[model samples]
Target chain A: MTNKTPLVELRNMSIAFGGVRAVDDVSVDLYAGEVVGLLGHNGAGKSTLIKMLSGAYGADSGEIFINGEKAKIRNPRDARRYNIETIYQTLALADNLDAASNLFLGRELVTSLGFVDDDAMEAEMRKIMTRLNPNFQKFHEPVSALSGGQRQSVAIARAVYFDAKILIMDEPTAALGPQETQMVSELIKKLKAEGIGIFLISHDIHDVMTLCDRASVMKNGKLVGTVDVDTVTDDELLSMIILGKHPHQKEA
Target chain B: MSTPTTNRSAKTFFNKLGIDLRLLGMIGALVILCVMFDLITGGRFLTPRNLFNLSVQTASVAVMATGMVFVIVTRNIDLSVGSMLGFIGMTVGALQVYYFPDIVGLGHWSIWILASIAAIIMGACLGAVQGWVVGYLTVPAFIVTLGGLLIYRGAMWWVTQGQTVAPLDPTFRLLGGGADGTLGETLSWGGGVVSSLVAVGLILASRRRKANHGFTVKPMWAEGILIALAAGLVLGYVYIMNSYTIAKGALPRIAEARGIELTEGLTLYHGVAIPVIILLVVTIGMTLISTRTRFGRYVYATGGNPEAAELSGINTRMLTVKVFALMGALTGIAAIIASARLGAVDVGLGTLDELRVIAAAVIGGTALAGGFGTIYGAVIGALIMQTLQSGMASVGVDAPLQSIVVGLVLVFAVYIDIVYRRKTGA
Candidate 1:
């Protein structure tokens, strides 16, 4: 996988807000069928770095390459044009609209007359919800009435429905019970099997160990290091996160 | 247990009817208001003549209220609408009285059309300018429109230097709805039939489409009842308008104008005012834009959650501009109706209409918090407001007391809405 061009590469990305270097000089890469875990504390800048890639924010300096070609992602629309989708920690669902409306928010399915094809969108949503979360039966209810797990399913379903080539999941399992978390872990694995590159932002060591192929740790807005999950123990990853020290550097 | 069960079944019935409970509540309130006023006015309130007048009077404010739905739904208030209406009305008034008569040689058939288009465009430009400041320059809408409220009012005064423009183009005056501004009997019935058919067609089309997608559709009985109710409303409105005969004093002039000999019991029907017709078109069009189109969806989504909408690739800033622009355009239409109806323009043209328009929208169940409002609701809200004022006037209530009552009603309506939302967990 490393021999081929990376599916997405964020090289030397940096962004600042009021002189605070929120995401400073970070580099990460992911290939096809890879899950790259981004681990950090509350203000560790993992979310900020991923936001730039998702086009929610622009980096002061960096390059994002998709399929080894430089990509211009000036906004979320541009990021979508590049087939990149992000499921934010907030789930990003409109509380007043139903599941189908939130599912196809920006890209609504419209009839030939240009009216929103709500029935068609609902039908499509029903199919996707059955596959993603079979227990989700509140299709007609606004997303505000949905449970946390149900909302998470809707968010995940949104990304998967769009055929996103690069999926960014920010704390995907953070708002779930054990069973729901297990379901998400299985979902990540299934998506990985289908050759989609994923950037999973997580604080759980167990999740990164089991779900990600490479774990990248960040501290104080800078990259600590990236390590092969198979080569690193849970304690090693924890130490790297806590001490901001890279064991891989010592090995080199 | 029985109470809860009954409530649940009633809810299910309403849901099956496909009518929003909030809208149904407003309709009920309107009916009750009409009945109360009818009784208080000793049966004068619900008469055809009064209803016709009520509708025509509702047209201008109702049109602006529809636009306010979009504005309020996007979590913005356009305080400048009243002033914008005044300014636009004065501008259109000036064009008809001074510019078009000179250019088109007076009484040209195209004067009304040209003036209307010009008014709409000017309104849109003014709205867009304010929208740009709010959307791009990041100014708060309240402040921007408050500034606009003052500026446009002053601008309205500046037009012709506070001079009242009167004796508007005869054709242009028709847009305001006098006896001449009506569609009359045959056309009103025709319009009513067409509207009823369209209403039924829309209901049927949506049901068939739902079935095509294998969705759970309303039962046949539910569908039939909804169709009947819609048809009845359209036809009933036409019947009321047609029942309103022209004033006996004006009949002689109309007879002379139409080249008809005066006969015993010559009657002229004011089927529907042109302004009312304009309001109807605006209502339907605004509803479509808010519900069926992508722009409408973006407005709601942005209102619901700005961050979420932005992240979903929606250009919320542009959406805000378009929403305000649409509001301004509607205000322009309202301006034409108002000025034309009065056959004159003055600085007081749209005075305090901002409060009335906002009150109507809020009363109609548009949430000030955004992302929730209906076009029909706003129209009904306007009617309710109009009904209250006119009903009070007919019963000889003091003007000051009428204002007090209207103010109380506005606050009460919002309180009811909050309670309803809380109880229903909507």
Candidate 2:
């Protein structure tokens, strides 16, 4: 696997907020068709690290490479230009806008006169949403009126509809029901089969064990280790999360 | 249970017609207010002459209020608008009366056009500068515009040393539309017909577009009813405007100018005034901008959730500046109307209009918390406020009492809006 260039590589990424290193010198790589689970407790800086890659925040120091070429990502627009899409845990959505408006908030479908084509956008939104969640019927209603699962579905649909090459799902199934969660797992597998790379942030060890090819653990804004999911047990992952130590590292 | 079921059905009915319930409630309130005023004033309030005057009075404030919808929609306040209006009016007044005549010779045809262009540009630049302070410097909008309010007012004082500029050019004064500035009967009828046709066309076009896109459309009867309603409104307004006749003393001059032989008891209709027409154009233009443009979409998105907007790669800071610039440009137009209508620019021009415009937007159901407003709502809100003021005057109320009543109405309107929003969970 090391013989070929990985799809995305983050090298020695570091960022600080108010003199505290929120993410310190974390390096990770994901190959094509791979699911890398990011496991960490609260404030473990997993989100911060991913944010740098997603262009939500600029890193103080780091280099990101895509397909063996160094990429500059200073903002969310740049991230999108690189075909990177992030589904934030908070499900960032404009509460007053309808589903289609939120789905195409920044990038809108416009007619030749440069007017927003609401009908076309609605048609497109309905088409994708039918495939993502066929039960989602509140197409004209603001997302705030939607249920948690429905909102999650909208966010997922947005990320997937854009044909993103690198997908970042930050706790994608955190607010979902069992069936919805199962649907998301199946979606991840399907995207993987299409050669898309996914970075999954999860606190659930079982999810990481079942859905991920590799697991990278962090604690206190620092990386503990990266391990192949096939080799590590759930207990070892838990200890890494809680004790901030790798399974194979010697204890002093 | 029956009540709840009926309410749901009513909501669904309006939803099928593609009408906002809140907007319908506002229009209903306006109709009730007008009817009550007409009754209390012994039928004087609904007279064509009074209504015509009321519409002309509402034009300036209504224009500014339309822009305020955008400003407040983006969660910003532009307190400088009133002072900006005064300042731009003074500058335009001076340009037309003094500088332009000197440069292009007195009574040059281009004087009015040149002065107007200067006023709009000046207002936009000033507004953009204030926006820069708020967006780039990270200052709160309230402080920036508050400072602008004082500075522009004082600047107006400095222009011509607080002396009122008067005797504006003859052609320029037509924009204010007193007697000679009206469209007259034939043009007014033509305008009404054209407006009705366009309204019907838009409705049909949108329905066809929906059907073409394979989306469910309103029933044929609903579309027919909507078209009829729109046409009725246009024709009704034109009819009222045409009912107002000019004074008898001016009849001979109008007849002679039109090359008609003067006859006994000949009457001439004063159709829609120019200022009101200007106001209509502005209202339609602003409505289209708010609903149909990408810039408008960004405004709502940023207003709805700033973080989400930024995450979506919207240049929200720049959007703030652009919105303020739009507000400024509208204020410039308002200045032209106010100054031209009064036939001069004075120290008290546009005084306290900032409060009036903001109140109109808020009373029009624009939430101060942002992300909610409509252009038509703001215009109607202005009309409602103007009705209260004029109605009270015609009823023999003192000026101070009129102010008090208007203030109370503003508060009441906001309270109603709050309850409505909560009830609807919007």
Candidate 3:
């Protein structure tokens, strides 16, 4: 990797909830302009590790670095200050609100008169929607009336609108059909082109192989290894997660 | 293309109209009851004088019902409004006789406004306390407000010593009864005509604004017909008032009958009741706040999903407190109106008023689950309840029967709401 400063780096981070070490002494470096897949079994602490990065949980020990600067992310608001945004499995879009309103949920654009600037918001929403996914046309309709993929787009748009540099997506394509999954994958690629580093957490090996640049496996709250996606097959990544050993190490 | 557009527009019109159809059905039932009673009473039920009295009688409950809509929309209820009203009314009465007469050296009008403000503030404080418990402390609103019902009522009894306060100043009495003296009096004709026109105009302007803002407006024809019907009703009322006769000064003349001298023929109240006017103004103001403001949006969001709203950085806790405060302010306003109309206050001034207000909101089409309702619907609901009560009373229906009928109507209204929700998949 040519970039000297990793966009995000975790050093010996650990969190315990009532004596259960959900994540223990896990460290990883995520560079800018890359998609890193975090994969594990259901209780392997992959979610806990990513949650710590996204500020949903506080680490018990160790540290998190953003652009080589040590950071304290006590809450979601603090994580947002460091341009870290998470799109949970539920998407968290206000279903009753339209796309423009959902896009600026927490921080809405307001006019000089101190009212929401509907016109400017609608225009910006249109531009973003067209750029990210041309098929998205329901601008005025509430997100509740939208398809699953479209709702995901609204959530992603919200994060991207705030200029998120480190994006965490939890199972973005889990409940979606192939077409919708493709739509989201394309959006991820667009985000990647824009130099946004993404942590794609998923159990779907095909999704990781097709979309992620590097795959990281975790088992029992510990990092097994990180491997380039191009050089490793889905079977090798599966074995790494299950057996907790690198394929190259086994070959050697 | 034109055919498809027209078809789509027609469908949209029906969808929007469906919301108000329940209200229309209630109004229709009221009209039928009026017609039936008019025939039974030899045309007395439809008289200009009786109609005018009905409007005044419904105003207090209608005003409180409007505020109740806000609470109901958030999936909360304020069961203490009745007791709160009684407490506020007694306080205002005491203030007028004691404080206003002594320290302030104020006349009736000044005392009325000041007392109203005091009542509103007191109500708001009380509401905030309850809201804090429900919203911040995460207590169930039902339990909190139910407790408020008992607490406020007890306070009222203790404050007034269970006595009926009376002999309010003549000016205060005029505010309640002076307007319709003889049906043709200038106050009745002028105030009624002007206010009705203003109401119609405001409704039209709002509908137009919604359309211009890219919101779906009801069908133009439906709106036009509604306006025409309202205008016709007002004009018809004016004509009836013009034709009524009463003795002004030993000689018989056509004038609106006053409530105090109904024997001289149909004299309208000498002027519009102050309470009625206040009710209209507050209803319109609250409706606007709910439909066209940022705070209103937050109310809906908080009710819909509190967690999502908080994650979006909205101050849900503050919004909840503010809503309760607003409800409190409304209760105060209603108390003042009730006190003015009765010319006194007692510990029981607002007895059972809370149940009626909550029932009015539910009957008016507001969902008990929150996130969907309107002040106008609530007012209409209150009117329906009051109208049913008044209509049944005129026919000598017993109190138990009235209760039974009201309960059945409430159940039916809720059933309709559930079915509509299921149909729309909302």
Say which candidate scores most in TM-score: 1
- Candidate 1 reaches a DockQ of 0.86
- In terms of docking quality, model 2 is high
Q: At residue A228, what lDDT does model 3 achieve?
A: 91
Q: Which pairs clash in the backbone of model 1?
A: none
Give the DockQ (C-alpha) for candidate 2: 0.85
Model 3: per-residue lDDT, tens digit, B11-86?
6665665434455656676677678877877777777567667767777788888878777777788888898888
Model 1 CAPRI quality: high
Per-candidate fnat, comma-separated: 0.77, 0.81, 0.20
Tens digit of lDDT per residue, candidate 1, span A1-252?
Answer: 768999999999999999999999999999989999999888999999999999999999999999999999999999999999899999999999999999999999999999998899999999998899998899888898899999999999999999999999999998999999999999999999999999999999999998999999999999999999999999999999999888767654
> lDDT tens string, model 2, B202-292?
9999999999999899999889889999999888888999999889888887677556788887888889999999999999999889889
Find the 10 residues in a row with the least total lDDT in model 1 chain B: B253-262
lDDT of 3 by residue, A1-252 (tens): 754799999999899999998888988878888899999998999888987877667889989999999999876668888999888777866666688877876666765756566556777887888876679988867677788878887887887888899999989888788887887898889889889899999999998999999988899998888889999987899999898888877555
lDDT of 2 by residue, A1-252 (tens): 879999999999999999999999999999999999999999999999999998999999989999999999999999999999999999889988999998998999999999999999999999998898999899888888899999999899889999999999999999999999999999999999999999999999999999999999999999999999999899999999999889988888
**Between 1 and 3, whose TM-score is larger?**
1
